[model samples]
Target chain A: MSTTNAVELRNVVKRFGDIAAVDHVSLEIRDGEFFSLLGPSGCGKTTTLRMIAGFEYPSSGSIVIHGREMATIPPHRRPVNTVFQSYALFPHLTVAQNVAFGLEMQRRPKDEIAARVREALEQVRLSGFADRRPRQLSGGQQQRVALARALINQPEVLLLDEPLGALDQKLRKELQIELKSLQRRVGITFVFVTHDQEEALTMSDRIAVMSQGKVLQIGSPTEIYERPTCRFVADFIGETNFIAGKVIENGANAATIETPDGLRLRGLTPRPVRVGEPAVLSIRPEKALLLAPGDARAGHAFAIPARVELVSYIGSDTRITVRLNDQRTFDVWEQNTLSTLDRDAYWQPGEPAVLVCPPDNALVLTE
Target chain B: MTLNALERERQRRERRTLAALLTPGLLWLILFFALPLVIILVYSFMTNGPRGNIVWQFTLGNYVDLFTRSIYFNAYLRSIWISVLTTVICLVLGYPLALFIVRQPPRWRTVLLFLVLIPFWTNFLVRIYAWQIILANNGLINSALRSLGLPPLTLLNTEGATLLGLVYGELPFMVLPIYAALDRFDFTLMEAAADLGASKRRAFWRVMLPMTMPGVAAGSVLVFIPTIGQFVVSELLGGAKVDYLGNLIQRLFLRSNPPNWPLGSAMAMAMMLVLLALILIYFRTTTEEDR
Candidate 1:
């Protein structure tokens, strides 16, 4: 893939009267990368996508697509296409005609348009269904037709606004994988917008998690999940347990924090933490281990006494919820394997348990 | 078995009660609509007597009189031409207004649509008279023209005045249905067309216009059918020089010597038949287009 940026937003600001729907924000998406804008509803992710597609204009700043500033360009004049959330296929036209529409609009040769439409249909694996209208197709097929319509234009960038949100869970999962593969095969810059973090994590090469009209953090899935830069990112991308603590020692790569319950915990610090500063230590549920008493070691693990609050068996794994003396709850997963359990020995309610999570697994957030 | 038979008997009694409840409306239609149409059919065959009453002597004299005279044929042709013209003008003007209303923001769309209907709330005859005053020789239009340094032109008592009245009176009828159709129009289709590289104008013609055709058909029927039978506009504005089909039938029934009742009945029946044919054609074309 080329290292050049395909699309760039430079301090873009969009406002609806007094309300700033998209605040001053900037981002650059490299060509051929499948980038996702991940956020909850009303977070201005869709507005950002619309700005990129030229459906909306930024109140300030500039959007440059393929090195050209697109301030005065209309949607139809822009060399970018959008796959709308609703698919938005033309009900009156057959799939072939819909796919050929862009080519026809460009006034290409009739035979070339037909050939390109056939090729696009084949690329989306919808070759035989080209004769059917959008209403005649199932939801999945209709979505594919919409994709074909956009892709056939050969736009420099394709903007997708929650394209898989209308499908059921299973269909959404299937399409997520299919869409990722399609993006890879086409090797085009894709700017996808969705509120589902799992969907973004599964398909995106990079994700920009946004909230309240601002981007909190942007990184790869693993980096975002393991090392979230803020409390919101840690909480939004995955479930994280926040424990209030005060910094006791600040080192080059690690910091020692004293928890409220008089426990000193050591964690890796991506940034410097001053001694005596208050911080929040975030630990993922799966990172915590359920150990028998006396199995924990100092400096490597912090052991806490708790009681099992709830246990749910989810086929391949069991989730155990434990409550501390302060009444704070935390979840730990126990994989169901031959050595672990034989339909018995599962922790039930009121049972005492020890939760042991490694110190390095905890991430400290100061803000 | 007794309980089952009792339930069946109760259902039969309920059916009878439902039928009895519906009988009044059914009887009213038969009396007012069916009975009058039958009476008109009978009257179309009878001759006009010396005392301006139907003589009950069956003849085809009225039908023969319609074709044998040039004045009646001309009046019919002129009425058809006027109705066609009014329908065309309404379509051209109403389609854009309806489209504009539909494209407004949701809150403003309701307010604008209410404005469209507000003009219709007044009495129909009062509105027609208001138009007559405006189109008169010394009315607002001529005075405005004169003040603008343009020569005063006589507009009333002309075909233009008749058409102006027809268009004004029927504009709401045309706009409402077209507005309804355009209101329900799927805007996403337009975006899809644009994404496919269509210009704004091409998208409008290819997607927006075709989708709103049902409204056009409905508006045309609503405007054309009523304007064809309108005598008030032509009579009040046409200065008694023009003789549309409605004026002919009105004169024959209420003012002509010997009443000319049979000929009036024939003319009324012919007008009704033409309206029926237009309605049938509209329905057929609209249904086929939908498919």
Candidate 2:
């Protein structure tokens, strides 16, 4: 991604009647960057994307696209184009006609419109299917046509509202990679919106995780997954096992928390955690390990004795659900490699085990 | 063996029950609709007797006379022309009304649609009489025009009054279907067009109109078919001076001495034929897009 900012939203707020659908969202998307708005339904991510596309006007703030204020501009006049969630391909028009729509609106030369339409179709890998209507194409092809329709305008910013949402899982994964590569090739700032965390994580250069009309965090995929600032973000971005505890000691870069069961745990603190403050210790399922009951623990290794209540083998990894002596459950995922147990030797119901995780891998959150 | 036979008998009995339940509506149509049409057909070919009863002799005189007589031909043409004019005008007026209704907020759409149907609930003849008062000389419209410093234009006993009555009577029939079609219209298609660079006008013409064509056709048939056969509106508003085919047919059957039933039957058959042809043309035009 380039350092130049292509689109900027300055304290934008959108209200539908009394409800603030988008509440004071401010973000800047860099030129050529693939940015995603990740949230659940009613999180106002789509509303924010619409504001940038000029489909919706911000109630209280300005939208700057390529250094121009898009407050009064309509969607058609904006330098941004949108690929709607429904694809929204003109059903009555042929594929060629649909793709040529933007060009025709620009009042381009007839010959040039035809040539560009052909080129756009080829770019989307739909070369010879121009005469067919949108209804005749498969969902993936329709999505490509939607992409071509927006991209042909050479827009400064392209807004995609769940473009792959209608596709099946297999097609969604295939298109995710394709869309990311397409965004890179086109070199235009792509503002994508999706509620699927994996889709956002796999494709976006940066993701803004939103909930209840407010963005909880905006960070790179690694940062969002590894260093989420809030409970919502930590739970939303990935799986986490949270333990309620009080901070017993605070060091320079790490902190120690004592669980209600009197188990002491040490973890690196991304944020300040004062001693005596209540906090939650978060650890990823994959970061935790299943150890034998007799294994010795080190100073930085936190281990808790538990009973394996369930073990599920999910292709590449085996997930074991363990219930601690204090009645709290924690999940541990082990990669299915040679070093792990064979399918027959995996944990059984009520098997005694110890859940161990490195101290540095534990995340501390103030709830 | 007896039980198996009884079970099979039960299945057959249930089938018979379904047929018996459906027989009444089927028989009703055959008696009230099909039988009358058959009678009209048989009477159109028979000769009218001295006492206006149908004679046993088969003759084409009534059909021949219908074509040869200038009065009958003119009346038929005038009714057809008026119905066509009314259908066109209703389409032009109703489309925008439907569009406006569809564009309204969802909660208001029901109330607005109800407003369109309220006038239809009143008795047809009573509604025509109400219009007669409104369009009459020194009536509401004339008074309004005079108050505006305009000359009191003559409206009653003219073709303009008949056309106005036709449109006013059939407007709800035209508006509802169009509203339904437009209300269900995929607005995303229009947005897609606008995004592709279509001006608002182009988007409306290319996307909006084609999608709603079926509604337009249905509304046209709804307005045209009834207006063409209507006698009450013309009799009340046109003052019986302008003889439409419906007025001619009514006069022949109800008022003429000895009741010229054969000619009336022939005229009625001709009207059915015309309506059938128009409907066929409409269906053909609409379905051609599929191919």
Candidate 3:
């Protein structure tokens, strides 16, 4: 991939009258990257995508697409297309006609338009459903038609706003994989917006996690999930266990925190933390390992004595809820790696155990 | 079998309920609507007596005179031309107004629709008289011109005044249906069109206009049929100078030098058939997507 940016925003702000829907968000979507803006509803992720597509303008910042400042350009003049959440297929037009709309608007010759439309439909695997109206197609079929319609334009950037949000779970997962591969084959820069974190994690090359109109973090899926720099990012992405405490020592690469009950825990400090300041230590549920007390000291891992409160065996993993010595409850998911039918093989409730996690796997985050 | 008997009983009850629902409307149409047309049809084939009386003698003279005479032929053509012009003008003026109203915020949309409907609060005839006061030679525009020391042009007692009055009377009919269509329109489709690189004008033609066509067809029918048969505007505003089909029919039936009932019935029948044909053709041309 080229190092050049396909789209860039410099401290963009969008306000609806008195309230800012997007506040000082600046990002550079690299060329041909499948970038995602992920957050819950009302976080301004869709608004940011709209500004990139020229549907909504930034209230107070510069937007550059391929090095050209897009200050006054209208949506039709912008070299971008959008796949709306509703699909927005023309109900009156057949599938092929809908896919050919963009080229027809550009006044291309009839034969070239026809050929490009055929190729676009084939790319989305809807080659035989061309003559059907939008209402006649199922939801997934309509979504593919929408994709074919937008992709036929060969735009420099493609904006997708929760395009799979209305589908069933099985269909959504199927489309997620299909869409990611389609983006790769086309090699077009995609700026996707969704509230589904798993969907974002599975499909995106990089992600921008937003909350309340501000971008909290931006990184790859691994960096975002494994090493969130802030408390919101850690809490928003997945299931996390947070223990509120005060920092007792700030070392070169890690910080140690003491809880109110006088239990000490050390974790990696992804962001700066001052000594004696209030902070929180965060660890993912799957990352924390539950082991017998004798196995805790084998790898220089930090260990806390706990009693198993509850054990629930799901097929893929065993979820164990444990109470720490300081009286805080923590959850740990142990993967079911071996096939076993014996009931006595699993850990029972009220049993003594140790909760251990590597220092690098835990993060010390600031509010 | 018992199952067959149950199905038969269900079908009988459904038929009874359908008949009960349709009885009143059917009776009303047959008595007040179909009976009058039948009377007109029977009268058109009879001879006219010397003193506005219908004589029991079969003749095709009225139908022949309707087609062969210059006066009746010219009146039919003029009425059609005037109605068509009025419908076109109303569409041109009302579409943008409907679009503008639909685009407003909800509170403002209600207020604007109220303004469009405000004229209906008064009697329709009173409204036409009000137009007469505005377009008269010594009326609103001429008075304003006189105040500005400009020459007062002839404003009333012309075809222009008649056309203006018809358009003013029928504009709400044109605006309401188009507004209803636009109000239900999904605005996101416009964004999709623009995102696909279509200019605002092209998007309007390709997306907005075609989807909203049902409203246009409805509005045209509402305006055209009424304007074609109108006589009050021409009489009051055009000073009874020209004979529209409605005025001519009125004279034949009620206010002629000597009443001509057979010819009047023939003329009315011809006008109704022509209108029915035009409406069918208009709907067929506009609704290709439905097929």
Candidate that would win on DockQ: 3
lDDT of each candidate versus the true structure: 0.87, 0.88, 0.92
For every candidate in turn, the CA RMSD to the true structure comes to 3.3, 4.3, 1.9
lDDT of 1 by residue, B1-291 (tens): 999999999999999999999999999999999999998888988999987888989999887887678888788888889999999999889889988888889999999889988977898778878877887777888889888999887888887888988898898899999998888888988887877778889998888887777888899999998888889989877766889999999999999876888888887887888889989988986786566
Number of the predicted model whose TM-score against the real structure is largest:
3
Candidate 2 residue-wise lDDT at B245: 85
Q: Could you tell me which residue pairs clash in candidate 1?
A: none
DockQ-sorted candidate list, best first: 3, 1, 2
List runs of model 2 lying over 4 Å from the truth.
A109-111, A131-133, A247-254, A262-264, A272-277, A290-297, A301-311, A339-356, B1-77, B103-107, B141-153, B251-274, B285-291
Q: What lDDT is reached at residue B194 by model 2?
A: 67
As a whole number from 0 to 100, the lDDT of residue B83 in candidate 1 is 96
In order of TM-score, best first, we have 3, 1, 2
Checking candidate 3 for backbone clashes, the offending pairs are none
Best by lDDT: 3
1 or 2: which has the higher TM-score? 1
List-wise, what DockQ does each model earn? Answer: 0.60, 0.47, 0.83
